[model samples]
Target: MDTAERTLIDPTHFREVMGHYPTGVAVVTGVVDGEPVGMVVGTFSSVSMDPPLVAFMPQVGSRTWDRLTLAPALCVNVLAHDQLELCRTMAVPRPDKFDGVDWVPSTLGAPVLTDAVAHVHCRQQSVVEAGDHWIVLCAVEGMEVTRPATPLLFFQGGYGGFSPAGMAAKADAELITAVRLGDRARPQVERLASRLECEAAALVAISPDELTTAVSAYGGSATMVEPLGQRVPLIPPIGEAYVAGAAPEVVERWLAKVGPNEPGLVECYRSRLAAVAERGVALSMVGPGARSDYQRLHEALAEYASGELTPARERAVRTVLAQTRHFFDELDVLPDETYDVGAVVVPVHGPDGRVAMVLRITQLPAGMPGRVVNGWIEELRTAAGCVERDLVGRGAQQASDYRDWWEADFPM
Candidate 1:
C-alpha cells in the first residue's frame, strides 16, 4: 500500500467506525459566575498516572466548554448504569440544565454530582488542537470511585449497561422482548401490590432456563422486595408456576436440570407442574417453624444472582433450591395445616394464549390460614386477568419481534 494511493478518511466513516467501541459516560461540572455548569462527554480518559492527568475532547467551538474552562476547577462525574436521564440533561446546552440536579461543591469549589459512580477534581493544565476538536488536559487534584457500580456505557450510538460474562447470561433480543412484556404488565402489578399489601412483581422468561423480574412494586408494609431485573432460575419446584404451562422443549429442559435424580424426585416435580397448571395458581407454603429453611433458600438464590459463584458453589445453590420441594407440594393442604405462605404466583396469558409473564406476590403476612391464602391467590388471578385483557386490547402478541434492533439492521 502506497501513501499516494490512500483515500482521504471521511468524517462519517470515522465516527461510525469509532462508535463500535464502548465508552464510559461522564459529566464535567463546575461553578461559573455563581451558577452550576456541566457538559456530558464520552471522551473522558486518563492521560498519565505518574502526574495524575486526565483528558477529554470537546468540539473546538463548544460554548459549554468555553464557559467551563473559565471556572477555577472542574469535577468530572462518572455516571452509573442507572443515570441515563441525567446524562441527557447534561448533554444539552442550557442555563437551567442544573435546575433539579443534586450536587455539592468539592474542596476546590467544583460541583460534584452526589450519586455519580465517581468524581475527579482537577485544574486545567493544557489544551491541544485536534482536527475539529480540542483535547483539553487537566492535572488531577483528587479522585475517587464514589459509588462502585457498573458504569454507564455508550456503544453504537445508544446507551446500555454492563453484565458480567461469567454470571447470569442474557441474550439482547430476548431481554428486549422480556422488558416489553413487563412494561405492559406494570399497571396491573402495581395495583395488585397496593391492594394485597405485599410485594408484587411480573416475571418474564428472558431465557429458556431463567426468568427475570422485570417489573416490581413494594407496597403496604412490605419489608423485602426482589430487585427489578432479578434473575430467578426456572428450575423445578422453584418456578413451577412458569414451567407448568411452558412449551414442551422448555419444560423438558427445565426438568433435566433437577439437582438429584432421586427415584421419584423427577416424577414429583412433574406431578407438581401438572397440579400448578390445573390449579391455575401455584402456592408455596412455609409451614410453621420453617423460617430458617426458607432463609437458607433465599440466601442461596442471592448468591446465585451475584454472578460471582464458583461451579461448586452454584451446585450447592441448586441443591438448596431442590430441597425446597416440600414447600411446593401444596396442591391439597388440609384445613388443619396452618400455612406460612412464602409466595403466590399466577400466569398472565398473551393474545396468542401463551404464558407471556407471571404475576407474583411475596413478603406476605406469615402464619396465614389456607382460607386467607386462597383469597390472596384469587386477588392475584383477577389482576392477571386484567393484564391479559389489556395485552389483547393493545394487540400484543406472545412474542414481539426485536431482531432488527438487536441484530443491528438499520434502514435509514
Candidate 2:
C-alpha cells in the first residue's frame, strides 16, 4: 500500500490487523535507584546475530521506560504460560510490582524474573525514535534458557500457548490411521473388563456431540450395553467424561441438544465439570429406587441407537440423560462415601492435552465395596495413562521424522 493509503488506516484497524500475528511475551527488567523495576512488552525481538543485538519498542510517554533506560543493563525475561499474572503485574502502573514476585539479580545487576522460560542479559547499545515509540537496542552479553515449558503467547488480544502444528497434525493423522486399520484399544479394554468383571468400552469422539465405540468387551457374567461401532450422542451417563474437558464451544453445542438451560442447571453442569476435573473420572451410580430409571435409560438408549425413537420419546430420553448427567460429578467431592451401584468413565489425554478417548465400565454390581471401586478407578486411570503415553510417543516419533525430512529438503 502507498504511504497515503497506509496513513488512512485507523488505529483500531491497524491494531486488529497486526494482532493476528502471535507474539511471545516478555518482561524487561532493570534496577533503578537500587530497586527492581520492570515493564511488560510484546514487541521484544532479536535484531542482529553477529553483533548479538536485541531490540524492544516502548511507548514514547512510558514512564517505566524513561526510568528503565537510565539503568546500565537490562534483562529480558521470557514469560512462561503460567506467568501470565506476573506479566499483568508488570504491565499495570504500580509502586511495588515486585513485592511478592521472586527474582534474583543478573550478572549486570538487572533483576532476572524467576521461573521464566529464558532470560537474556544485555547492555544498553543505542536508542532511536520510531513514530510514537522508542526503539531501544541492546547488546546481548549473556542468555540462558531456564525452563522447557511452553512460552506465553499473545494473540488477537488474548493469552494462549502454542503446540507444534506439525506434531498435532501428525497425531490426528495417526489416530485416524489406527482407526482405519482397525487397531482399536480392544486388548486394553478387554483386559480391564475381565479384571473388573464388568462391561468395558473404548469410545472415540468423532465430534463434540457424537462418539463411536471403537471396541467393547463384556465380562462372562456382565451385561452387554454397547457394541463395537455403536455411535451414541455425547450425553450424560456415558459421554460426560468426554465432554468435561472439551472446549467451551463444543460443550455449548452438546448442551444445546440436552436441556437444563436454566441458570441453575448451567451451574449444576459447571459444578459437575469441576468434579470431573478434580476426580479424573465420571460416574453414574444407581442410587436407591433408581433401578427403574436406569431401565428406562437403557430402553431410551437402545431406541436412540436404532433410530426408532419418536420425537417425543427422544425429548424424554434427553431429559432423563440431563438429569443424570452429573450423577458422578460429586463422587470426587465425597470420596469417603460409598455408592451401591454405578459406572465409571475416564478420559485418556493425547499430547495436546485433549480427550483422545474415553474408557468406560458400566453396570457395577450393587453393594460393591468402596475400596474395590477405588481400586477399579485407579486401574482405569493407569490404563488410560498407558494409552496416552503410547500416543504421545508415536506423535513424538512422527514429529522427529518430519523434522528430519524438512531439514534435508531445506537446509538452514
Candidate 3:
C-alpha cells in the first residue's frame, strides 16, 4: 500500500484491477462559436446536492477539453444503452463530431443530445489539476430526465447494460403465476395429460441457466415425477424446445458456457436444433435407459436446487450433462424397433414471437403403433397453437385496456 509498492504494480495491473468497477457513459457537450462541440467522458460524478454540483475528469492532453472548457456552460448527456455509436463518435479526435448527430440547445445554450436518458445543464464552477487529468467541476443550473431507458455501462474494457436482479425475479414470478392462472392453456394441458395417460407439463425459461416447471398435470402412471416449480438445467432433451427458437447469440452463449468443444457433438446439437425448427416440435425417447438416467439426473438436480451438493459434485453433474448430449439427438427419429416411453414437446410463442413456454407429454407406453405416435405429435402441436393464440389474444386485450385508460386519464 506504500507509494513504492504501488509503483511496483504496473499501469496495466492497476487498470485491470480498477476495471472491475462499472461506470456509466456520458457525453459533455457545449456550444462554442455557433458550432456544436462534444466529448465523451466515463468519469462523470455528482459531487453535491445542496449546491447542485457535478464533476468530470478529462485527460489534460485532450484538445476537445481545451475547447470545451472555454464554453460558459456544459450539458452532461447520460447515454442510453442504444447510444453506443454516439459514444464512439465523440471518443476519437474529429473536427466535426456532431456531423449527422441530432441535438438541440438547452436553456443555457449547451447542446443536448437527443434520446439521452437525462441531461444536466451546468455553468462552469471550478477546476483542479489531478495527476494526468483535470477535474472540472460545474454548478447545475437545470436538468431534465428526458426518457426512461437502460443506462449504458462501461466495465472491464467493454460496454454493457444493467438488468436488476429484483426485476428478473419479479418477471419469473409473473410468468409462473400466468401459467398457473391460465384459463385456456393450463386446462388444455390437463386435458391432454388425461387423454394420453401421461404427464403433461408446462416449462418456462426462468433464466438462461435453467427452466422451471411452472405447472404440471400428472396422469397417475408417469414413471418420472416433475413437480411444480422444479428447475432443470437448460440442456438438451429437457430444454431443446426452448433453445430451438432462442436467439442465435443466446444459444451461442449457453453453449460456450456449458457445451462441450467436441465438433461431432456440436454438429449433432446443430442438427437437432435444425430439426426442432423444421418440425416445430422436439422429441426425446424415454426408454428404460433414459428413464434411469433422468431419475439420477433429477435427484442430482433436486440436491442442487436445495443447495445440498458440494461444489465438486455440482461440477461433476454439469459435466455429465454436457457429455450426454448424444443421448438427446434425433429423439423424434423412430428407431427400427419400437421403444416404450418418449416425450413430445411443442413450444408456445409469446407476444414477441419468442418461445415463452413449452407443452411437454412424457411416458408413452411401449408397443405403441407408429400411427398413434404420429397422432400424439399432431395433437401436441395443436395444443401449442391454441396456447399461443390465447396468449396473443390476452396480450392484445391488455394493450387495448392500457390505451383506453391512458386516453381517459389524459383526455387528449
Local distance difference test scores for all models: 0.81, 0.74, 0.74
lDDT of 2 by residue, 47-109 (tens): 999989999999999999989998889999999988899999999988799999999999999
Give the TM-score comparing model 2 with the true structure, all chains together: 0.50
lDDT (C-alpha) at residue 174 in model 3: 39
Q: Each model's TM-score?
A: 0.56, 0.50, 0.51
* lDDT score, candidate 2, position 412: 23
Ranking by TM-score: 1, 3, 2
User: How many angstroms is residue 146 displaced in model 2 relative to the true structure, after the best TM-score fit?
Assistant: 72
Collision count of model 3: 0
- Model 1 residue 329 CA deviation (Å) reads 1.2
Local lDDT at 381 for model 3 = 88
For residues 201-234, write the lDDT of model 3, one tens digit per residue. 8776555656677778867586546667766666
lDDT of 1 by residue, 263-346 (tens): 478887788788888888898878777788898988988776665454556678778887776877767655555678889999
Query: Which candidate would rank higher by lDDT, 2 or 3?
Result: 2
Task: State the TM-score for model 3.
Answer: 0.51
Looking at model 3, residue 26 earns an lDDT score of 98
Q: After superposition, how far is residue 337 of candidate 3 from its true place, in Å?
A: 4.7
lDDT of 2: 0.74
